[model samples]
Target chain A: MYRYLLHRILQIAITMFLLIAMVFILFRVMPGDPASMVLDPKMPPEAKALMKKQLGLDEPIYSQFIIYMKNLLHGDLGRSFYYGRPVYDVIMERLPNTILLFTSATIISWGLGYALGKRIAWRRGTRFEHALTFMGLLFYSVFLPWFGLIMIWIFSYRLGLFPLGGMITPELWTAGGAGIIALVLDVLHHLALPLFVLTLLSFAGAMLLMRSSMLETLREDYILTARAKGLSEKVVRDKHAARNALLPMVTALALSLSFSMSGGVLTETVFSWPGLGKEIVSATLNYDYPLAQAAFIFLAAIVLMANLVADIIYAYLDPRIRY
Target chain B: MSFFEIQGLRMHYATSRGRVKAIRGVDLKMDKGQALGLAGESGCGKTSLGLSILRLLPNNAHITRGRILFHGEDLLRKSEEEMRRIRWKYISMVFQSAMNALNPVYRVGDQIVEAILAHEDITKDEAKERVSELFSLVGLDPGRAGQYPHEYSGGMRQRAVIAMALACHPELLIADEPTTALDVIHQKQIIEKMDELREKLGMTMIYITHDIAIISETCDVMAVMYGGKIVESSKVRDLLRRPMHPYTQGLIRSIPPLHDSVGRLTSIEGEPPSLLSPPRGCSFNPRCAYSRDICRTSEPPLRQLNGGLVACHFAEEIPWP
Candidate 1:
């Protein structure tokens, strides 16, 4: 197991380095000049040239790559072009909101999807199973942006059960007009629609996958063995069959959490929720190479970590898996 | 009332082709401490009959007509809820494929403990004790029970399965070809272990196997089933010395003699008849060397012969084993 861990950590380190190099090279080769974008249009040619050199844009691609790596190793992610703040700081500010918003939605959907999926598989031939299967697939395949828009139109605009858009009331927030409790409540109120939209978007895939996995598990010989053990139907389902059937669901949770570092990008943008996804969008439009690459590097770490966590989870879920 | 009995049991499977009659009008009865050996080649309904007693047949299969009476209670008339209570607590099965019978994720001891906890109002500590006892009884070290199924060898896995079957100390244990997957040494060890347990616990056992050698070692009474029907049944000693049915005679002859390694030892001539659209008369008629015109036209009933039961038109004519 120690050997396996060492191998996996080595793989992760190599992968992260390659990713940083690739992102650095790709951003450099892109058509837009970061210096021109960051500086004023009225600046003198020599001043412009000085700004380019200051930003290290005047260096060759290979030299720039080495500088980026050296700076990255020392915990410097450079500065954002548009904001003139450290790229790390800009992302750090939005990280909590993104995590808070999407994590809750993802977890709730995953849990319910897993539980409901097992039931759907067990009662496969029944009408309730079929109805749930159809609805889950339909919701799962619904385009995320379109679904978010519809949720806003109906729940926020038509029904008035939720706030229309934005993370919080910015005016009140900026002035510190509301108490801490009131601010928290206002944030939750704003969170409801986007949370609902994000939950609805990811729910179906988990459910459908669990349902199919459970159906296969039901046919396993251990299920019959459990039945022969005189286990009640409920115990047999939950303890014997569903426990084993849940392997894929666990994998889904780990992978989704890891790979979706930029989760609900369009949803965050549509709801104007001030998440990293929305921040990345603005950073992209403004040609903030440092911010974009910082976000990309963060996502790379998440994906690599998620892959490791997935392996560990697989070992936990199935005793057959060792390292 | 008999300890356990199955009367007029017909188990049929619905395939894409049609309904296949796996067990057609079979009858078997066992006393409280009696062990019945159900010997047959593959597809002779031995496994089907074993599963029918527990009402654990697959989704596509059902008992067409049957009465499984345990202690005079008609199991066929029992609701599914009642059957669930009867299972494991009263009668448990050691399935054919022991290697896959255990849940791969759980420790072997946990699976056994779970079975004990299911029917008994016992604490986890008590359950763990029972699991260890079962493991020890099956010749496995109790500490090894913490290991997963894959960690155990195939034979050890089969032993663990046997331990799990005996967890609740069921009155009746149905072992469907339990030793078929093991090596000869392991087979002997398992049989010896089970025999010791049966003597200690007095549980009724139904031993299913194709190998006649296994039957003599494990079972007291023997029933030879072919084409989903028991053609002959008697004390194992009696049947071995004098097999009245021609099919039984052929079966006994097929076992390779310990000393004589001569030209290919005799084997039952043809393959087992397909359950789907089975032959009209005796399903074994196509393969039976002694099959007569009457044997080809009519299904002979199991009738009493000299101190034993035989289902053959000319049991008296087939002189000796």
Candidate 2:
């Protein structure tokens, strides 16, 4: 197992390296330069050239790549010209918000999905199963941006139950004497709509996967054995069948969590929530290379880690899965 | 009353095509501590009969009419809760495919522990102790009980499943082709183990298999099934000596003799009838050598014959060897 872990870590290192190279190449290939974004267009060519040189853009691509790699080794992500701040600090400021929003949403969605999926699978031929399956599919396939808009319109705009957009109320937050509990509640109140939208959209995938997996599990001979053992229907369904059915959902959860960590681009944008997703979009548009590349690299690193965690968890859960 | 009795039992599977008549009207009786072997071709509903006793048939299957009386009480009339209590405690099964009958994710011993814990009001430690005792009873190493099902060999897994079936000392044990997937050596080992258990515990058993030879070796009474109905049932010695039903005679002839020189092994021709749409009258009429117009027009009811039962229209007329 240790050897396998070492091999996987080595593979992750190579993959991260390739991803870093891809991020560098793709950002450089895109039109627009950081120097141009920072310098006024009417400036003299000499002043622009000096600014480009200062930003190290005048060097050939290979040397620039080497310098980027060296800086990366020292955990330097350079500076965001658009924000006029270190890229690491800018991303760090947004990472926790994105994690808090997406991770909680994913966990909550999957918890509901798994609970419903197992029941629907067990009661497969019943009308209740069909109704739940249809509704879950509808929620799963609804366009995310449009759904987010509708959620905002219904809950925030028309109902006036929540803030229309943004992660917190600027006025109340800026007033500065609010207790920590009140501030946390305010953040959560702002979080309600986007979290609901994301959860509804994401939960269907887990439901469908778990339902199919559970259906297959129901056919296994061991289920019959469990039933014949006089286990209550609930124990047979949950302890025996659902436990085995949960294998595939583990991988699914990990992949979805890692993917969503980049932030739900449309969700954050729709809510005007200051998450890494929205930051990445604006950083890319403004030709902030350090911030954009760092965000993308962070996403790749997280995806790799999630996969590793999923493997470990799967091996632990299923005795058949040897390293 | 007999220790276990099944009367007018009928079951069907509701497939998309239509209802498959898996178990036609059948009756069987067993005394306490007796081992009855059910011999039949594949898809003859032997497994269904076992599942029916435990009330563990698949959702698609329905017991259209039946009375499974265990110890003078109708098992079919029992509620689901009652059946749950009866199962594993009063009756348990060693499934047809013993290897897959165990959960792959759980330790083999733990699964038996679960079964014991499910029905018995015992501490976990007591259940664990029972599991170890069961493992040793089935000739498996008690130390290997911690291993998962996948870790055990096919024969060892079959033995583990037997151990699980015996965990609660069920009054009736159903051994469904317990040695079907094993090699010749393992088959002998399992048969010997089962025989030892039977002698030691004297528990009522129903062994289902297609191999008449195995049935003859291990069972006191044997029943021959054809197209989801028992056509002949007698003492294993009597059934072998005088197979009144042509189908039973044909099945016996199909078996290879041990001491005979090289000769043609006679095989019964024609496939088993599909249960979805069986023949209009007797299920085995099409395949019976003695089949006549009357045989094709009416079903034969199981009737007493020479201190046993036979379901053949011309049982007396068909001269025996």
Candidate 3:
């Protein structure tokens, strides 16, 4: 097991290196002059040259790459020309918010998707199954931002039940620890709209996939053998059917985790929620190359880590898998 | 009264296309301490018969007609709750492919103890003792009971399954091709162990298998099935010496002899008729060499012969070796 883990870690290191290299090259090759974007066009040429030299944008592409790699080795991700702050500091400050939002959404969607998928599989050909299938398809077909907007319209505008945007209300910010609780509650209150929209959009495909997988697993001879042993229906379903069915879902979850982080950009922007998605978008629009590069690296790391974790979980769940 | 008797038992499966008659009207009785073998080729419904006896058919299938009496109680009329109480307590089954029959995550001993604890109000320690006893009863090392199913060899896994079946000391044990997945040597050993256990425990058994030779060796009375009906049933030795039904005769002739340089073994001419739209007469008539006009027009009823039942129109006319 230790050897397998070591091998996986080594492979992840190589992958992360390639990912960083690719992102760095792509950002450089893009049609944008970071130096000109940072400095005002009306500024004197001499002042612009000094600013370009200071940011190391005046160096040759190859030399710039070497300097970037050296700084990356020392854990220096460079400073953001747009924010006038260290790229690492900005990312670190924003990491918790994105993690909190995406983590909750991931857990909720996976849990609901698995439970609903199993129910659909069990009660196949029933009205409830048909309704859920249709609803899932309908929800997923709409764009994420549009879905978020619809949810906001229904819950925030018409019903006036939830906060329309942002994490917390002004009153909650000034109230102390009770203030913090109120703040969290307010955040969660506002969180419901976006969370629900994201879950509805992402959960359908997983539910469909899980339902098919479970149906296939149910038809396996082993499951029939379990039933013939006089095991209760619940036992047969949970222990025999669910365990085997969850195998493919584990792989799906890993791939989805990576894609989900990147895919939340539009939803985060619509909600105006301070997350990596919004951060990356604003950085790209402003041509903040360092900030954008840092965000890309962070997203890549998350995806790579999610995949690695999935591999480990897969090996644990099924002894057939190793490294 | 017989320990277990199935009267007028019938089962049909509802498929997307139409209803398929899986088990035609059938009757069987097993006394205590006797092993009755239900023998047939694949899809002949021997396994279904075994499962129906336990009320364990899949959702698509239902027992349309029958009374299954276990110890004078009507099993077919019992509620699901009552059936759950009876299952693993009085009646248990060892399924085919015993290797996969067990849960891979659980230890073999715990699985047996689960079967025991589900039926009886016993402490964990007592259950553990019983599990070890069961393991030893099936000729497995008691020390290896803690190991998971994957840890054991295929033969050992089968022994573990047999151990689980015997945990509650069930009166009626149905083994559905118990050794079908094992190597020849393991198959022989498993069959021998089953025969020994049956004698030691004095339990009635319904052994389902496609191999007539294996059934002949282990069963007291053997029934040959075609399509979904039992075409012939008699003492194993008598049926082997004098198979009455043409299908049975064909089955016996198909068994390749180990010593003789036999020419290509005889095979039934055509596939078994589809149960969805079975032939009007005997289901085996299409493949029977002695099939005649009556064989095509009228279904043969299971009739009493000298010492057993034969479902054939020309049972008396067919000459034997």
Index of the highest-lDDT prediction: 2
- How would you class the docking of model 3? acceptable
Model 2 alpha-carbon drift over 4 Å, by segment: none
Of the two candidates 1 and 2, the one with more favorable TM-score, higher being better, is 2
lDDT of candidates 1 onward, in order: 0.87, 0.91, 0.84
Candidate 1 deviation (Cα RMSD): 2.1
TM-score of candidate 2 on Cα atoms, chains taken together: 0.98
**Candidate 1 per-residue lDDT over residues A184-248, each given as its tens digit:** 99899998888887787778788888899999999999999988877888988998889999987
| lDDT for each residue of candidate 2 in B1-321, tens digit (9 for 90 to 100) | 999999999999999999899899989999999999999999989988989999888889999997999999999889999999999898989998888999989999889989998888999999989888888898999999999999998989999999999999988999999898999999998998998898899899999999988989999999988888999999999989888999888898888887787577778889899999989778888887888998888999999998889998889999777
- Between candidates 2 and 3, the one scoring higher on lDDT is 2
Worst 10 residues of 2 chain B by lDDT: B258-267
Report the poorest 10 consecutive residues by lDDT, candidate 1 chain A. A255-264
As a whole number from 0 to 100, the lDDT of residue A307 in candidate 3 is: 83
lDDT winner between candidates 1 and 3? 1
Give the alpha carbon lDDT tens digit for every residue of B1-321 in model 1.
898888888889999999899998898888899989999888999998988889898878978887999999998898989898889999999999877999998999998888888789999999999888888888899999889899999889999999999989899999988887888899888888888899899999999988888788778899999888898999998898899988898898889766666656787787888888888788788988788899879988999987889899888887772
Where does model 3 exceed 4 Å of error? A170-178, A258-263, A319-323, B258-264
Alpha carbon deviation, residue B204, candidate 1 (Å)? 1.4
Q: Which ten residues in a row have the lowest lDDT in candidate 1 chain B?
A: B256-265
Clashing pairs in 1: none
